[model samples]
Structures are given as C-alpha cells and as structure tokens.
Target: MNNHLSKTIKNEMFSHHYQLLYNLNDFKPFGVEILFRSSLFSNPQRAFQKAKELNKLYELETTSISKAITDIHLNSIQGQIPDHLFINVYPSTLIHDDFVKTMKNLIEQTSISASNIVFEINEEELITDHYSLHNAASNLKEEGFHIAVDDFGKGYGSIQTVIEIEPSYIKMDKFFADEIEYSTHKQEMLKSMVTYCEKIKSNIVLEGIETPEQFFKARELGIKLGQGFLLARPCPLEDL
Candidate 1:
C-alpha cells in the first residue's frame, strides 16, 4: 500500500477536491475544505493509517499539502477560486520540527498568503505533548494562518486544547449533528456551544449536515457555516 501510495503521490495520481462550505445565513459559497482523493483507495483514511504505521506520515502529508497549495494558488490566479481553502492537518505533523520551515518555503514559492489557508487541526490522535502543540499552533497563527480545531469536544484535551490554541474556528463533531433536530437536549447543547463560540469570536461550523431539516435548524439556531453532502460532496476542483 505504501508503494502504491508513493506512486500515486509521485505521479500525481491523486486529485484534490473541494467540499463546498455554505453560509447558512444565505447559502452562499463561503469557502471550500480541500480534500484528497485517489482511485487506488476507496477510503483515504486507510491509506493515512498505513502511512502512519510505516512512519512516512510526514512525507505523505507534506507532499499532498504542498501540491494542494500550489494547485489552489494557480487556480485562484486563473479565476478558479471561489473562496478560502481549508486543508485538514494532523497535530503531530504541525508540531514536527521541520513543519514551519516546509510551510514557509511553500508560501514563498507560491506567493500565497497564510491568510488564504485555514489549517484544520485533526484531533483524532491522543495528544502526548500539549506544550509543543501549543507552541507550534501559536507559531502558525503568528505566521498568519488561521487555525481551526476539528472534533472539538470528542477528543483528548478537548477543553484544554480549545483554551490553549483559541482556534479561529470550532468544528463540532458530527455526533452532535445526528438527528439534532429531534433532541431538545442536543439543541440546548448546541446553543450553549454556539454562545461560547460567539463570545470568543471563533466561528462555529456544524459538520455532517445531510438534510434540509438539520440545515434549517442549524441556521435557525444561529450557525453561520455548514458542510455536508446536501451542500456538496468531494469532487474534482473543475466540477465546482
């Protein structure tokens, strides 16, 4: 799988797709979360897991990110950009020693401002070094890249991470979006979260919204941003 994955990345067999994000206020194209897809794997997560096992996760991650940024920059220059680019990133990769240097080089080569990129921090892994992660995240912010925390309350150091990093966006886990319209408790919970996010000026985005009912409910509750199949799926950039 690693060899196959290497070939895919090396040959650019993989493509970057956009998952459209909408402003629930008026359903306009707010931005896109850039996603990677390849015919070699029906599930990209499996490939990422394999990369981690092989200790080539950094190579795999940085290579794809560099490609995505370069492509998005050129596309934007050619009138292909609809809005900002949100790219998913791993915490470990972000804190790695070479991370900042690699990113700076990309920015220099592409001439794309950090403001144009939002690095969504994937909190799926257990955080072993909060201090290192915090310093790295802070440095990214200093470099002008917006930081978003993914799976906000469903991971280790959920609250501590939020307080430490103070992400520019808080992406609520899909568990809260599951039939939330039917649960008063869930509604109240979301409302509380919404309030807190608002207070801190960190935009709150609801993920996995697949129905009009959930969409409208989220909007009614003051959610300003959302993403899911109902709005759009991961597809080739040209499709957008």
Candidate 2:
C-alpha cells in the first residue's frame, strides 16, 4: 500500500502547499499547516464504499493523505525549505504497523528533517480507538515528527482528544477565527485555549485569516501564527 501511494503521489498531476509560519508576536510561537489542493478521494460515496470493502478484507493500502505528505516533503527538500511541513494522515494508516515502518524508512531516505515534519491527525477519523491512537502518536513522536490535532474546536464537540493526546500544535477551526471579532465569549474561549496551549508548550494557529480585520484580531488576541489569503496564499514551491 505504501508503495502504491508513493507511486501515485509521484504523478505530476498533483501539487503541494506548505503552510507558512507567521509569528503572532515576536514572543509568540510559529508553525505551519499542510493542506491538499483537492480531496484525497474525489468521489466521496464511491470512496466510502471502497473503503468499507477494503476494511472487510482487513487490508492496508497507502492512503492518499500519506502520499500527499510524502509529496510535500519531497517538494520542501527540493526547494530547500527550512520550516516544518504539516501532512495529514489517515487513522487507518496510523494504526498500520507496515505504514509506520514505511514512514520511518522514508524519513531516513529523504532529505527532509524528521523534526521539521508534522503529521496532522484530523479529529473526524481520529476518535475511533483510544489505544491505537496512543500507540501511533507515541511511535511518531519517538521518531521526531510532531503531531497536530487539526480543526480542534469544530469536530466531535469535545476536547477529550486534545486533552488526551496533548499534541504539539492545535489549529483553531475557521469558526473561531470568524467569530473572534463579534463575540466576547468566543474571544474568552480562545484566550483560555491559548493559555492551556501555552502551559503545555504548544502553539495555537488561527486559520482562515482572509482579511485584514482577521489578521489584526488574531494578533491582538495573541495568536501569532496565522494562515489565510491576507498573509499569503498557498503556492507552488517554485514560487516561494
């Protein structure tokens, strides 16, 4: 499966984007997010059905997410990027020993530094089994790749996963970023979350900063790391 993803990602059709590091304040921490230009499975219904059938067979295949990450890493290395690159990964891949082994091997073979690579564990698919996640995170952390809990506030309506995993970075949902201007409640909530993040030595990144107002609001609230159309849009590595 890993081999399959590797081959598919090498296809020239796909392009990768690296999340930029914007400082919240000089004292604020910096970080990045990796996003795909398109959905991993373009056809959701078909993909789900195929995934279900694959599950019935209990077979492991390299996920599109993993392939995309690998692609981003290679791009970064070729471009000589120094910032950490975030890559989204599927839960099934996280639980697969073969995938883990392949990832470790790939890291060794690649020019990208393990410490500058981030694996983004999306909450929608991450909550199924507790033990598998724990072991997967532990294994990845031990290998020097940081973990980020993507879209933290919007999914599953709880912070149980965040508390449990204590990932290296937490990405605020677009909702929070949108609401930071009008609601004191939202502002306070973000402040508390940022405070908690500070205690754990993790950085908080405000996503969807598409406007000047959003950028100012995030900075005023101490969110140094940001992403949106205002600062810079995702581009080919060659452009950077």
Candidate 3:
C-alpha cells in the first residue's frame, strides 16, 4: 500500500475502534480505552506490535490519544461521559519531548480536565532512563493528570518504580489474580501490595478478572477498582 492510502486506512480504523471501561463496585460505566483493530489484526495487542515493528508506534499512540479525547467529548455531548478515560501509553512514548505538550493541547481542544484522564503506562518494557521517565511522569502529575502503572508486578523493580513515579494508581497484574483462591503466595503478595499502596495512598486496580470467584477474591483483598470480563467487557462508546 502507498503512504497516502495507508494513512487514510489507519485514520478510518482509529475512528471506528475503541473500548469502554467499567467500575467493578456497581458495574457502572467508568471510562473508555482506545483500541486499534482491522481485518489484518484480531486485537489491539497484535496491531500495536505491528506498529512497533514498523517504527510507527509513536504515531499510533498520538492518533489513539486524539481519537479518544474526541470520542469522550462526543459522549459528553450525549450525556454519556464517564469518570475517567484510561489511555495505554508506552513508557518510551510518554518520555518524548513533545508528548506532554501534545496532551496539553488535546485537553485544551476538547475542554477535558486533565484529572479525568489517566495515562496507563505499560511497565513491561524496560525503562533504562529512570530520570526521563520520572521527569515525564512528574510533569503529567503537575498538570493534574493521573498516572497509573499497568501490569505492575510483572515488570522489573516494579515496587521501586512505583516509588519513583508515585503513580496515582497501580494496576495489579493478572498473573497474581489467576488462581488466588488456591495460591497462598499470590494472596500474600497481593495483601502485601495492598498494604504498600495504603502507605503511599495509591489506588489499586486489578485487571483481567474473568470469574465470579476472581472478582470476589479481589474484593476480599480490598481492591476497589477492577477491569475484567466478569465485571465488564470492552465495548464501543455507543454500546456503553
């Protein structure tokens, strides 16, 4: 495909694709998480990976952010906007020089409060420059935007990273939630993290919850927010 055609197709894909997030407490609508989908890829993970391979990950992230903000404004006009919108951003992308500037511009353009949007950082990738990451995070926080470290425990020095970034939210990786009913170690780890979060005043969000058992287990462990199939599945804004 030529450059112009590819750009047009990508723009169209961004327009039609996105998912809604929900609160686990009352199962009420929470926010939207932008997703990329097409005939060539069945899921956002695959599509994002392809973008990375093509060295277009930054462009993809920028487009997703813009589209998400626009969608939220449209929903607001319809009186269907939620509490917070979660946008998955790569750590590298967050650290870019123009990243925060672009975010400010989008917030201004959409008339969305920075506090209503949470930048969910994927911690699975190695963050070699902690200083840059910390700087970017600090800048966002100062701007009143919330920050979350996604897939928390699965990454390197996650606890340390959490301390450094001082995220407003920490999403517990699903691996810990997989079989907590049977795994004593997982239960203890979660309990410990909960205690840690309490000390830091950071909220916890358990992801990938798929069963009633898992949902109850997470609740028992004092997880206030959660995202999973049991509580709610991803859907378009109109469906929400």
lDDT per residue for candidate 1 within 71-115, as digits (tens), equals 877877876675567888888898999998899889888757888
How many clashes show up per model? 0, 2, 0
lDDT of 3 by residue, 1-240 (tens): 335335734765644444555566677766655554555556667666666667777777887778778877977887766677788898889999999999999889875799998998887668888999999999999999999888988887687779899998888888987987788898888888889889999988887888888888878887777877776666666776
TM-score of each: 0.94, 0.79, 0.90
List candidate 3 stretches off by more than 4 Å.
1-10, 15-32
Give one digit per residue, the lDDT tens place, for model 2 in 1-240. 444333434552334565566775662324445555434556433343354454621131244445555665676666655467776655655677675677777777666667977777756563677677778888888988788877878766337767777788888887887857877987898888879999999888887777777777788887768776676676655554
lDDT of candidates 1 onward, in order: 0.84, 0.66, 0.78
Sliding window of 10 residues with minimal summed lDDT for model 2: 56-65
Off by over 4 Å in 1: none
As for TM-score, the candidate ahead, 2 or 3, is 3
The numbered model that scores best in lDDT is: 1
Which residue runs of candidate 2 sit more than 4 Å off their true CA positions?
Answer: 1-13, 26-32, 38-79
Worst 10 residues of 3 by lDDT: 1-10
Clashing pairs in 1: none
